[model samples]
Target: MNNQIKLSKEKREDMIALIKAYFLKERDEELGDLASGFFLDFITENLAADFYNQGVWDAYTYMNVKIEDLLEIQKY
Candidate 1:
């Protein structure tokens, strides 16, 4: 099973820019394109799954609540 998170080219560029911005603003250091890209790739490869799983869990909980409400509307 491939767990790697594949982002679109536009999204990847956006993320790289965001990472560079964060470093410049927060760390007072400028990150080059290669460094920012490597950072983004590392995050995508290593940390994205945790975030994705959390989103899935949140969606599941929300759906369960909606399903319960749906059952309450049934005529019996």
Candidate 2:
């Protein structure tokens, strides 16, 4: 599977902004636009898949519980 994920220009900028905010808030470090852009690129390239998989797993677990609840209601 191709591991490349593409983001729209607006979304890219938003992610960079978020990264900058994170650095400033958590690390007390000011991250420039260029550095934040590079950090976003690195995260998207390296970690997006794992993040996506985790989201899918979470959704699956939630749905299973909901389905079980429905089934139990139907048994009454």
Candidate 3:
């Protein structure tokens, strides 16, 4: 499929909640975009991969193919 499929309401909400959790955990705040002093790029990428592997959503898998390249390309 090519982005034609739609996720159910619960699945969509779950995705949003996951992103919210990541943002909150990374920023130590509920709104700010700043991530913890740690290597957030790594953390976020890994989180996305984990989500993809869980068989719930594929939003993150778009990055799965070039993950290694992305990791090498990112500065932080």
Candidate 4:
């Protein structure tokens, strides 16, 4: 199973822009495309999996609740 998360080109650009803007706003450091791209890569490679796993867990919990509700309705 492929665990790699893939973003569309537009999404990638948007994220990069957001990263650049965030650093510029909060840190007062201007990040160029190369720097921001590297930062994005680092986040994507290292941190995204953790976030993705959390999302998967959240979805599982949500679906479980829905399934329980469905079962309850059937019991009525």
Better of 3 and 4 by lDDT: 4
TM-score of 2: 0.74
Give the TM-scores of the predictions, in the order they appear.
Answer: 0.93, 0.74, 0.34, 0.89
lDDT of 3 by residue, 1-76 (tens): 3423345767655555666687778866563223232334444455655755566446456667579677888776
Count of backbone clashes, every candidate in sequence: 0, 0, 0, 0
Off by over 4 Å in 1: none
> Model 2: per-residue lDDT, tens digit, 10-70?
9999999999999999999999999999999899889999999999999999999999888
lDDT scores in order: 0.93, 0.93, 0.54, 0.93
Sort by TM-score, top down from the best = 1, 4, 2, 3
Q: Give the Å shift of residue 22 in candidate 1.
A: 0.7
Which scores higher on lDDT, 1 or 4?
A: 1
RMSD of 1: 0.9
Q: Model 4 segments beyond 4 Å from truth? A: none
lDDT of 1 at 46: 89
Question: What lDDT, from 0 to 1, does candidate 4 have?
Answer: 0.93
Q: After superposition, how far is residue 40 of candidate 4 from its true place, in Å?
A: 0.3
Query: Judged by TM-score, which candidate is best?
Result: 1
Pairs clashing within candidate 4: none
Ten-residue segment with the worst summed lDDT in candidate 4?
67-76
Candidate 3 lDDT score at position 41: 43
